[model samples]
Target: MATSPAAPRAASGGPVRLSAAPADVAALIMHEADLLDERALEAWLALFTRDALYWVPADHGDSDPLRRISLFYDDRSIMEDRVWRLGHPKMFSQNPPARQVRVLSAPMVEASGADTMSVRTKFVMFEHRLREQRTFGGVYLHELVRQQQEWMIRRKVVHLVNRDTVLWNIGVPI
Candidate 1:
């Protein structure tokens, strides 16, 4: 969608120098995390673009979500399905449900254009379910697009620092 003059501009907003702490973009990112932690999947999905991707690579620094084994490589349709399953009473993995606490730091702007920006941030996620807790630490790289006058995530790639290790089947969305 064409950006309206009233739209909240990102780092590339004219002569202003981009800072790591781009307030507007950072707020969206944090809000996304909060939605997930609250298990508000439907609300969380609204933060993405229609063709968005939620990817978790099997190996650190891997970009090929399709070619490699991944915890998740969901597109829009898949995301919706996952969200449905998460709320389904019959979904076994969620027997006890999962609780999560995620901390995201100021994102480093990797690339920025008029309608797109790539930002990377460090994340430490604590997920607990079924009497067990797992701490997942990694870098979250997000590619956001300007759509309908908002910054929507086009692609969110998560590279777990311990991706090389076995996951034991994490029952929760990271």
Candidate 2:
């Protein structure tokens, strides 16, 4: 990828510095959601570090993407291809692509460091197409890094409340 190299992951065992005011981190997340709702996949992709992950687990509280089934477990390349395919004119599921709207709550700082922060937020998204509208709710956990005064997502783990339910062609991102 032509994006900036991935910033090193903050050691999980390190002393985490939680921020009292994580508004900036929260704003970046909302902006990304806006980009997705606008179907600006490429621009949305740019908000991530080169080695970022976009994951959605199948089990209610699953943490291991490698050990179990998942709704999505996309690395940079897979994410890129997914965005490309979603925008392709020949994609039937998106023939008349659903319109998506996301409402994200204020972010709660979960963990932080000098260069990394994890924010958790609740989201309710509605995908509308034709005469149908499907509602999706979840918790969005983002691990973001500070690079040159910019906050970029290193990992986005979404735990959907309806993870086990049968969903339609989730052609659009949550």
Candidate 3:
């Protein structure tokens, strides 16, 4: 996608200069959700950089994933292992393969640098498995870097609305 040197309103309601347009940013985000919805785990993993970090903080206020307990704090290697396990035929947790659909709001460019951009988007994901349905809603904070002709995720933080509560099995990537 081509990017324009325009500023867009950030999630905090302030304008930030960015090399990417809101539409371009939203397109990347929507594509990621679509990949997950299609269960294209390998393709989804390809959206991140080699040193990517995926985090889901246990609490909304918690910072520093290293010092705080997180629902998930996975680096690229861990993500690779997870992708393998999720695809393994004998992975009991994914025996039936949970179905997921994610709805995301338009992405807002919160900040940007020469080769990187920070974005925030609200999301709601619905998962169905074992005859049960669960809904997860949250805000997603993404640090994206321009790689070649595409944007690759460097860090992704999922701030779940129910972060403080005990959650059911989230066998698949969120």
TM-scores for all candidates: the values are: 0.85, 0.87, 0.87
Residue 104 error, candidate 1, Å: 1.1
Cα displacement (angstroms), candidate 3, residue 9, comes to 12
C-alpha lDDT score of every prediction, in listed order: 0.79, 0.80, 0.82
TM-score of the candidate numbered 2? Answer: 0.87
Estimate, for each residue in 37-65, the C-alpha lDDT of model 2 and write its tens digit. 99999999999999999888778757678
Clashing pairs in 2: none
For candidate 1, the C-alpha RMSD (Å) to the true structure equals 7.4
lDDT of 1 by residue, 74-163 (tens): 899999898998899998778778889999988767678888998777899998887898888887778999887789999888778877
Model 3 scores worst on lDDT over the 10 consecutive residues at 1-10
lDDT of 3: 0.82
Q: Per-residue lDDT tens digits of candidate 3, residues 1-174?
A: 111212455689887454334677778889989999999999999999999999887876777889988888999999999999999999998789988999997787777778888887779999888998888888888889999968889988888886667686776778
Instruction: Quote the positional error of residue 174 for candidate 2 in Å.
Output: 1.0
Off by over 4 Å in 1: 1-18
